[model samples]
Target: MIKIFRITAKNKILILGSNGQLGSHLSNDLAKLGEVTSLDRNGFNFENPESLDLIIKRLSPKFIINAAAFTNVDGAEDFEKIAYQVNALTVKKLAILAHENNAVLIHFSTDYVFDGLKEEPYLENDIARPISVYGNSKLEGENYINEICSKYLILRTSGVISKNEDNFISKIINLSNDRDELNIVSDQQSSLNFSGFISQAVLEILTELESNIDKEKRWGIYHLSGQEPGTWYEFAKFTQEISKKINPDSNFSKIDINPIPSTQFIQKAKRPKYSFLSSVKLKEDFGIELPNWKKSIIEVMENNE
Candidate 1:
């Protein structure tokens, strides 16, 4: 059943996965809202769910933003058990804990939850059919949250990148420095979102939620991914283009990025050929429109320099 939540006593905001790129940004930005507590996943054990119950009860947060996730797409295929435990089961525990504590559980999800079968961008309520274990695990987590918690949000995003973390853009720059060319997967289509963008969006959502806590329409899954849709090849090429424009004298400007089919780039996991997410719901509901991939790439490239 859907239960509307209102923050009464404990107004602390707890941020999980404090070490990640998005988590780090969120930790810093959300502090302005209220008393913030940032917890790293390593500090607690997900294998034993009961251990977290004590910790969360002590924290007594009004808002629990869970960013900790097992995001290794390829590694999930090998460590399937651990992946499910960390991504799904642990998230289920979080939902239950938040429901008990009367806290709004804001969780981060992924575009991988949808298989790349549809040509159009995936929406919030679209039927999800994941192509990989990582996707399945994340979907399971979302399902648990939906079933267990009423005052919660599931923000589905794509490849979240930033200069502060070792993301795709940073990796592309590093590879270009070492190798003469980069062969990126062109057949796959998705968006590369900036961590800063996501953090800011979350901040806005938190502000709105705090102001009006009983709005049932505000709680649910929302797409907070990049506005622009492009293939990996396009992302890489844009990275090179921006890096070169930013630092023309650097080697980053000289390296070439080549496009190849997903088959050419062999991997244990199968990625969605198209998982570009549409943020119309987020904008329509929360009045937040995420920026384009090009702008985010430019910011990351400039920071790299």
Candidate 2:
């Protein structure tokens, strides 16, 4: 039987990109464990990599959670250099700093790292064949973290949504409020991740690490995301359905959701057609499972309202 670990106030946690959807949730959830020094883009600029090194050295946090990234998928196609700098170069610097400080680095990655050609859910050791600049940059960041930091947890999640940020669900909600109908892609397939659930899982993993378990076995890349796989059309439809259920009289309740192919929804970035991540490794190691995407959507929608 695996023993659950408890967190103490002595564990100093530093959260980068604290203002983001996932970062915001992490800051709130992780605060219960210890002193959390949350930093948004303004607080710590990735433009200046040196600033990261300086801050990590000064704070000397026991746990450094990097939730920040250049997440503009289509924008990255035009600005690859900026994306690489923010996502890959800065991450490499953070890993180095974390290693020097003897801190456990917790970094967030994406399912986009995969080419999405595989029909089955991707495992942790799957070969990454990123098709877009954003995906490439994220893959590079993962590589740097794995090489530089001996004690690190790289969580590769998919389609992260939350009430606080402009994610897929929020976009659908906003669009439904204005438009009568929507064209959602039906080709793309992946699990939707809730930032709140991801944050909670991270905390639980931290607790396990804080315990006497062999840190080496636990420290590595793990696929953490929703259990159910779905297409963008289904995700949007469910969002609309749940929104209507939550607010029957709301304008969003009447909007029509139409399913379309990926070719019709042309974008600058080429997203993977199928990039679902399997959380079996995480469950086997930590004995934790993420909540269902449908349940998470309802909770987020209700909470935001």
lDDT of the candidates, in the order given: 0.86, 0.87
Against the hidden reference, what TM-scores do the models get? 0.94, 0.95
Pairs that collide, model 2? none
TM-score of 2: 0.95
Off by over 4 Å in 2: 1-8, 213-216
Error of 2 at 39 (Å): 1.0
Steric overlap count per candidate: 0, 0
Q: Residue 195's C-alpha lDDT in candidate 2?
A: 90
Compared with the true structure, what per-residue lDDT tens digits does model 1 show for residues 1-305?
11112234346888888878898888888877877778776666566666788878887888998988888899999999998998999999899999998999999999999888998999988899998999999999999999999999999999889876478877777777778788999988899888998999999999998987976567889999877899989998888787677788767688777889998999999999899999998988889988899988887777763
Write the residue-wise lDDT of candidate 2 on 1-305 in tens digits: 11112345777888888888898888888877777888888788887877777788877888999999999999999999999999999999999999998999999999999999998999999899999999999999999999998999999998888886578887887777678789999999998878999999999998888775344567899999878899999888888788777788877778778999999998999999999999999999899999878877877888884
